[model samples]
Target chain A: MNKVWWKILGSVLVIYTAIAGLLLGVPRLPILNESIRNLYFHVPMWFAMIVLFSISVFYSVKSLSSKSEIDDIKAVESVNAGIIFGLLGLVTGAIWAKYTWGQFWSFDPKQNFAAISVLLYFAYLILRNAIDEEQKRAKISAIYNIFAFPMMVVLLFVLPRLKDSLHPGNGGNPGFNSYDLDSRMRMVFYPACLGWILIGYWVYTIRFRIRSIEVKQQAN
Target chain B: MKKILFSLLLTLATVQLFAQDNGVEMADKLRSDGKIYVVVLCIVIILFGLLAYLFSIDKRLKKIEKENFPKN
Candidate 1:
């Protein structure tokens, strides 16, 4: 976790994304136009969020077996970091929707499901705060987290596709891959996902460290 | 017969013109004027600034950890 190289690599990759994502050529779809560029900035946020939430679940499972406070801290801090990315995803998606889909908050299945999934994590945080006893809090919240993770996945990924969604790749609509995600866009999009995921992990580690420190300080 | 040939040529010329105008529009004007670079530079600067801040926080936390837990 303390390794510096990956953090530096992430920073460099993100900076590269900021420059290349804007300058690079993209598909010339009619409604999307230049806003197709949002693929680099917006889609990656959810990818990073999903990754961080996965890490949170892993730590939660560890906390359950080991009954360790440190593992609990890791779980909760990762959720906190993941929530930040999730919110960013929601806001960015809304802004993109406004211009392309003609509304900031279309009742699109994907958008609604995304919002609900983020709320699920919010409930996880609240669940933690509601409990006071340390061991009970860790154990119960870990169990809740394990359940929440799968629910989030289904809500965001599965339910949207099952219904009619204005968002791409849902319902009967073909995804960007079939139409707009040409090879040129992939060059920037893939790197953006990787870079943001790394940065999200970096943020999670920092939050974990700080929270662990606070726990230690409280003990002393 | 001559009139038919002339009208077919006219229609072909109009079709070519229509295709050119039908091309999808993008922010080509901004790119050509060189102002898109300004947006990119500003975003990069903000990204660097936030990253630097995060790094400093990480360093400070490391220092505090060492001081607080000397054995670990």
Candidate 2:
């Protein structure tokens, strides 16, 4: 509630990015052409997803140490928000790839790893649901969350870089790094990441509040 | 030289895409006519509408919590 201004800023930034991203002139690279504009919509989803998942892992660590119910609630909500963003990123990436690469699923290293990492999170949700007792569920899932976060990082960030990837910056493929370093694209891209990440957090906060309310209701 | 050639091909590709799709326009006309505002407007409307729904849910949840949970 007190952080309402940031939420407003986030929404404003997203809208601004959307409009500007459409109208702004890009480098006119081959294969990308106008679709380079997807940088605003698609790339931000992954940034937001990673931010949310990191928040989830942080809270999982908190719950493990402090053993607080609120911490677990925060963890679960962050993961829920994270999964939503990850799925959005995947779908958008697929659409962009289809228009450019001539296929929906190219089995690109980045894409394959991304799919596996998302499945890892889905497995986290399944693990959570498999447990019945509240504290037991929280502790076990928190552990699974902590366990899963590192593998996801390796899957998404580290491994992709190590191998030949269709994505930029990997396998010697020219990626955003080529244009991202010195271009007007940076002007919109960074803000887009911040905006989408804030929006994800806003959603996470609301989900946490709702779950907290449910917890109180159950108590009564 | 390579960049120029690639750009030329890409431009043709975009043009070909526009030329091929008639019944299902790719908004090429809208973009060329500088009427992308229409697309922007529609997208902004959808984004704001979703945010508005979230805002309403937040308000309702707060009210329910206030009514159901005693203040300590």
Candidate 3:
């Protein structure tokens, strides 16, 4: 009863956004046209991914300090959840780009940097698998997780801004707030981001619970 | 002075009706004929269906937990 409300809210907000996003009016801009509705669905995936990745890093730091296996389980599960959202963001962004930017993979700084950051996390996962022992795996991966997180921050946030790119808020491009997004869109957009982030957290918790059960079974 | 400010704000608000950008073509035909709801229906169904699938998995995990672990 206590934890269920937000999960229910996430589902409700997502459904509301899907309906309102399609039916509600949007700002008319060149190239985006009707596809501006992608703002509701596509943008939320990255917001959710970023939120989950931040959670993963926080738990990694906790596991390093506390030496708790549960913290390590949380860190790994959050990463797994984050990766799913990241891939969704990448594919949806590519599809949106193809319609608007002429090519699916046009070497846009945002796209390239995004792919690299995802690969960096994947490397973290592989690094964990290579170690057979639990304590060594947790500590070493926590170090790597902490180390890689700052570089990923640079890759996703700063590097893209330094180069010419088609992504909003990059190079000379205007952001949604500057043009496409208006007060009406904000009504849906903010809730959509909140909904997706909450859903990502929900998925992470479920995965954490399942992993904990497995660990307990193994112990017994 | 209060009346002047109120009138000015009202005028500013109404000016948006005459903004310069040309309006894009909305799917007026589909919306008018009510087919746009079909698209909305499909999207809602897909979103809810995925959520339902997740809930089922959660139930299965709960069952496993009950079977194997010490109940609190």
Highest DockQ model number: 1
Q: In candidate 2, what are the lDDT values of residues B1-72, reduced to their tens digit?
A: 999999999998789566765546565556674688788878889889887786677678678767876582
Please list all clashing residue pairs in model 1, or write none if there are none: none
lDDT of 2 by residue, A14-34 (tens): 988988887777786788778
Deviation (Å) of A39 in candidate 1: 0.3
Per-residue alpha-carbon lDDT of candidate 1 for residues A1-220, written as tens digits (9 for 90 to 100): 6889998888988999999999989878899889999999999999999999999999999999999899999999999999999999999999999999999998899999999999999999999999999999999999999999999999988899999988888998888889889999899999999999999999999988888878888888
Q: Evaluate residue A119 in candidate 3 and report its C-alpha lDDT on the 0 to 100 scale.
A: 91
User: Candidate 3 lDDT, tens digit per residue, A158-203?
Assistant: 9998999999988888888897689989999999999898889889
- The estimated TM-scores of all candidates read 0.88, 0.85, 0.87
Error of 3 at A204 (Å): 0.9
Per-residue lDDT of B1-72 in model 3, one digit per residue for the tens? 999999999998767656523545565555663587879889999999998887788788778878876573
1 or 2, greater by DockQ: 1
Q: What is the lDDT of residue A107 in candidate 2?
A: 93
Root-mean-square deviation of Cα positions for candidate 3 versus the true structure, in angstroms: 9.8
Q: What is the per-residue lDDT of model 1 for residues B1-72, given as tens digits with 9 covering 90 to 100?
A: 999999999998788667556655565555664688879979999999998998898889889989987887
**lDDT (0-100) at residue A16 of candidate 2?**
83
